[model samples]
Target chain A: MLAFIIRRLAQSVLVMLFVALIAFIVFRYVGDPITAMVGVETRLEDQEIMRERLGLNDPVIVQFLRFIGNAMRGEFGISYRLQQPVTELILSRLPATLELAFASATIALVFGLVLGVYTALRPRSFGSAIIMAASLVGVSLPTFLIGIALIYIFAVELGWFPSFGRGQVVDLGSWRTGLLTESGIRSIILPAITLSLFQLTLIMRLVRAEMLEVLRTEYIRFAKARGLTQRAINFGHALKNTLVPVITITGLQLGSVIAFAIVTETVFQWPGVGSLFIVSVQVVDVPVMAAYLMFIALVFVLINLIVDILYYVVDPRLRVDGGGAGK
Target chain B: MTEPLLSVRNLAVEFPTRHGILTAVQDISFDIMPGEVLGMVGESGAGKSMTGAAIIGLIEPPGRIARGEIWLRDQRIDNLPPEKMRKIRGRHIGMIFQDPLTSLNPLYRISDQLIETIRTHLPVSRDEARKRAVKLLDDVGIPDASRRIDDYPHQFSGGMRQRVVIALALCAGPELVIADEPTTALDVSVQAQIIEVMKELCAEHGAAIMLVTHDMGVIAEAADRVAVMYAGRLAEIGPVRDVIKDARHPYSQGLMGAIPRLGESLERLVHIPGSMPRLNAVPPGCPFNPRCPKVFDKCRTHRPATSEIEPGRRAACWLYPGVTEA
Candidate 1:
């Protein structure tokens, strides 16, 4: 088991290295950092001095090594647009994006699993048919459009929620969160729903398909014949079998929820890193962009690693070689 | 006369497809006496397994028991609601499915699967269920049952896994167990061992077994009575020895002859010529008529209903004067 975990950790390191390389390449070539860093009034010689001071003249490998070294120390220089250390900038915005991502992901997972299993167990029922048809909207509509429509309905016409921004936030140490406040909770409802819609549908459909498939398996029939209750057969035996693939898909979707928070963040004007990355993009703030890329990659790699571990925990077949084969 | 532990009266299973309703098992009736292993033998599509499924009420949708009555003793189970029938299944009529590799849930430990089923049907504590499960496993010939109980299904080989499956079926000590092709997916060497373990354990538990298989050897060894089905209809049913040695129905005779005898050598094994008819394409009369070597004019025009040919034997064949014309 330890060896398995170590092997997975090694694979994650390689993935992160590749992502780091991509982030470095994107930062290096996308725009002139010096132009963005200085004003139009600055002299060319002064600009050269600043560029030299920043080690811009160094070879690609050296600069890349320097970037990797700095990244390891949790440094990403300064965001040119915000005039703040990129790490600190991201850290400040981290709480918002993380909260939204987690909220939406929780919504997506809980509702998706329940609805998926329900639809699978009662595929012919009227409620299942309606739920299935409604899920198509989630699959078809773009995130931005969903967010906009939600705002128009709940914020503009209904006057039930604020149209944009995190309403009010409380500080828990350095972390700022709207979760504890009423207005803040209300404010998150629209964006979170919009962010969750696409993933929820994907998860629901995948789970329903998987559940249906599992229910038809010989084990399920055997379970039924064993006189297990409908609840035990469906949830205990059938649902547990469906979760291996579901966990893999849900993990990937979770990474995407954070990465794609940009659209929902922009539409709702939520004070999250996605919006920060966008503003940095317009101004060519390479440090923040590179940091954002690295952060997203880290989330994905971490999630993949966690999912791999979960596979070992959930499925005994995978663990037999590592743990049971010895016995 | 001993009361039948299970009785089926005019059971007909049908599948409704786009074209028409196809009868999978038609006019099937039989009785399983208490603690007796009744082997159901047939070809791949002969509806042997379908009969087993119908008794347990596990028939898949669009296909159902269109007309039938299944009685567990005198309980009249066929007409029972699904919930009531479910209660009877594990506690009264347990089932062991084909493919032991797939019958046990791969995600669960053998203990969890066993204990869960035990507690579901029997009033027992977790620890009590665990103890019973281990004992049942040991009875089924799984070595080191207590230690191995915690291991998942994949830890065991095919034969060991089947022993676990047998243990699972008899865990709640049900009166009857429907074993559907239990050894078909196993190694040829392991087949006899599985059958032996199943029969012995079921005997110890006093559980009657409805063994469904096409293997006549298994029936001869383990079954007390044998019922031969041909194309969704019963061709013959009698004591295992009588059916194997002096089969009354032509199809059963052909089936018994097809088995190569140990001492006698032949150029080719006696094989029935035509395949069992598809459910939709079954002819108007006796399902076995076209393939029967003794096909006659009456057989082409009329179906033969199951009727007593001997004091304790039955055959559905036109040649048997006692068989009522359908």
Candidate 2:
């Protein structure tokens, strides 16, 4: 198990390196940082000075090595537009995105699992049919549209929440969160719900399909024959089997959730890394863009690693080795 | 004189599809006395498994009991609600399925599955249930039962897993067990071993078993009384010896003839022509009329009711009308 984890960590590093390389190439081709920074009106000599200062005069490989070295030391160069350390800018906004992601995932998982199992259990019921139809709408509608609608209803019309921003952040010694204050919690409600809507539907549909399939297996029939309560058979036997696929999809969806949060962040104006990403792209801030790409790739790999470990914990059949052979 | 342990009177199962309601098991009736093994032998799709499923209240949905009365001792159980039937399932009636791999939960340990069944039907502590589970496993011929109880279903061999399934079925000491083709998925060599274990353990617990199988040899070996099903109806039922030696229904006679004899070097095995009809196309009269050599005018137009041929023998065929009338 330890060897497996170490191997996965090595793979993750290789993936991050590939992502960094791609992001570097893409950013270089998209626009010239010098033009964005010094402006088209600047003198050629002044532009040359800026270029040399930023190490752009060096060969691409040399500049890439320098970026990698500085990144290793937690110094992701200065942002071309902001003139501040890219790492610090990203770190400041990281909390908001992380808070939204965590909240949305939690909401999606809890409600998705409950509704999914309930629908699977009483598939012919009117309530289940309604939930199924609503999930379809949830999947079809765009996130930004959902966000705008929620803001209109809950913020502009009802005055129950602030429509935009992360509200007030409370800094504990090591951890910082906007969730501790009432207005801060209220501010995140609309954006989080908007961000989680699609994921909740995806999870619910995946879980409901898996559970229905599992419920038809012979063991479930035997479970009923064994006099287990419907609750026990549904939750204990059927739900556990359904979770393997659900967890896999949930991990994959988490990656997309972070990706899609960019649109949601723009709609709600949440001060998160997604908005920072948009700003960086618009201003041709290569350092911040490259770092963000690598960071998101790293998160994807780590989530998948955690998912693999969870698979081992949930399924005992996978634990057997060659020693169990020929028995 | 005592009431039969389980009585099924005119039990019928049907499935409702877009076309219409298709009858799967039609007006089948049988009784299992205490400690007796009633072997139900038939071809695939003969409704033997459906009969067992209906008894255990585990019939897949859309297919339901269209007509029947199921009595467990003195209690009328067929009309009970699902929760009430569930309470009776593991406590009064246990079930063994065709495939052992699919019968046991893949994620649970044998001990956990067994103990859960034991505790569900019996008011026992976890520790007590665990002990009983281990004992049941040992009784079903699992080696080092206490230690191996922690193993998952996949860890055991095919025969061993079936034994564990039997142990699971017998955990609550149910008065009756419905084993639907319990040895069908096992290897020929190990099939006998599982059958031996099931027969011995069931006798030890004095549980009446309705053993559903298509293997005539198995029926001859394990059953006290044998029921022969044709399509969706009972063609013949009698003492195991009588059914095998003096089968009255022509379909039963053809079935006996189809089995290969040990000493006789026959040119070819006697096989009955044609297959069991599909539920939608089952003939309006006797289900076996199309396949029977002695089929007559009355057989082609009227469904024969189950009638007593002798003191302890019964068959559903127009040829036995006079015997039944007497």
Candidate 3:
């Protein structure tokens, strides 16, 4: 088992390297960040100096190799727009974005999983019908539309919060000031709720479908006949086997969660990397945009690696590293 | 004779369809004696398994035991709530299904599954459960029973897994064992091995058994008394020797004729004339009227009750030598 984990971890490194390489290529070749934002008064000489300073004048292959080398050593260089170190900007803004993402996914997972299991248990009852209908509405509406819909009702009509913008994190950064502050937590609710709606639908549907299929299996019948308690049968026997794909859904959806957060933060002005990335894009700050894009992609790669590793913890069958041994 | 252990009287199973309540098992009655092997023989969808599952209170919803009483020893168990019935299921009545490969959980070790059964009703310590698991495995003829207890279901062969299932059923020390086509999923040769092992195990434990199967030869070899089902009703039942050699019901006779003898011509072997009637649209009178060779006007219009043919043998047929005079 340790050998299997080691092999998987090694593969995770290869995936991360491949991802970082693609991000570097796409940041440079796809669109010219130089033309989109620089001032007209900036001299050709000054531009050349900027190019040399950021290493843009270097060979593309050489630049990519250096970037990977630096990343391996934990240096992300400096951001062109903020005139700050890239790692510092990402680290400072990362917590807020991560906070929103984690809260939203957690809410979705707990709520959706419960609703899904409840529906699957009853199958065709009235409660299940309502859950199915709710799931339909949850999935059918696109994320941006849901975000807009929420903004209209919760922010505009209800006037429950500041329309946009995260309240200053400085005061809250200190526990002396931030403890259960009305402004700190209230600011995050709409964004978290907006992000959770879509993931909830995805997770709920997946869990319900997997649970239904597992319930029909002979082992389920055996469990019932084994004198194991009902709680044991449903959760211990049924849900335990259904967890592999739950982890997969959680991991896969984290990417979409971040992506959806981009639009959500843009709409709500949540103090996160998503809104920060958008600003860097509109102004075409090449270094900052490159840093942001690369960071998001790396986050995705790492999440998937974690998910792959967790598959072993969920089902022992996949832990083995060989062909199926016939009894 | 001592009172029979289980008495299922006028048992009928039905499902509510769009048209109406369609009866599946129609007025079947039989008794299971303590320390005896009663073979339940029928074709697929013959209600053999429905009887087994129903007797254990595991019948799926919508399909209910419409009219009947299932007595265990002296207690009527048919109408009890699921929670109440669950206590009796693994404690007093044990079961083994046909698919050994799937009947045990893939996620659990054989020891874990068996230990769970032992601990559910008995408050034995983990060590005691572990010790019992090893003994049960050994009793079922598994080699390296102590070490192999930690092995998963997939780690064993088809026949071996069946033995594990039998061991699990007997782990709780129930008085009656219901082996529902326990060897049907095994190779023909392996099937014989499973039957022999089950017979010895149940006899050793002094537990009566209801062996549900479709194999006539298997019933002949394994059963003490035989209950022959047609569609969903018990058409004929008697001591295994009498049921096979002197079957009174035409349906039972037709079933015996269907099995080809080793020395007999395969081409000349007889087959039942037509399929059993669909549940939703059973024939107006007899459920098997369309296929009964001895069908008469009365047989087509009114169903025959299970009248005793001799002191202990009974069959639901108008043609039983002194049967259905009414």
Ranking of all candidate structures by their TM-score, best first: 1, 2, 3
Order of quality (DockQ) = 1, 2, 3
DockQ numbers for every candidate? 0.71, 0.61, 0.48
Residue pair clashes in candidate 2: none
Report the poorest 10 consecutive residues by lDDT, candidate 3 chain B: B317-326
Candidate 2 chain B: worst-modelled 10 consecutive residues by lDDT? B317-326
Query: Could you tell which candidate, 1 or 2, scores higher by TM-score?
Result: 1
> Compared with the true structure, what per-residue lDDT tens digits does model 1 show for residues A1-327?
789889989998898889899999988888789998888999999999988998899999999999999999999897878788999999999999999999999999999999999999999999999999999999999999898899999999999999899988999999999999999999999999999999999999999999999999999999999989999988899999999999999999999999999999999999999999998888889999999999999999999989998998898788857434324
Question: Which model scores highest in DockQ?
Answer: 1
Residue-wise C-alpha lDDT for candidate 1, range B49-108, written one tens digit per residue? 999999999889888998979999879998789899999988999898889999999999
How accurate locally is residue B170 in candidate 1, as Cα lDDT from 0 to 100?
A: 88
RMSD of 2: 1.9
Docking class of 3: acceptable
Q: Say which prediction, candidate 1 or candidate 3, comes out ahead on DockQ.
A: 1
Q: What is the interface RMSD of candidate 1, in Å?
A: 1.8
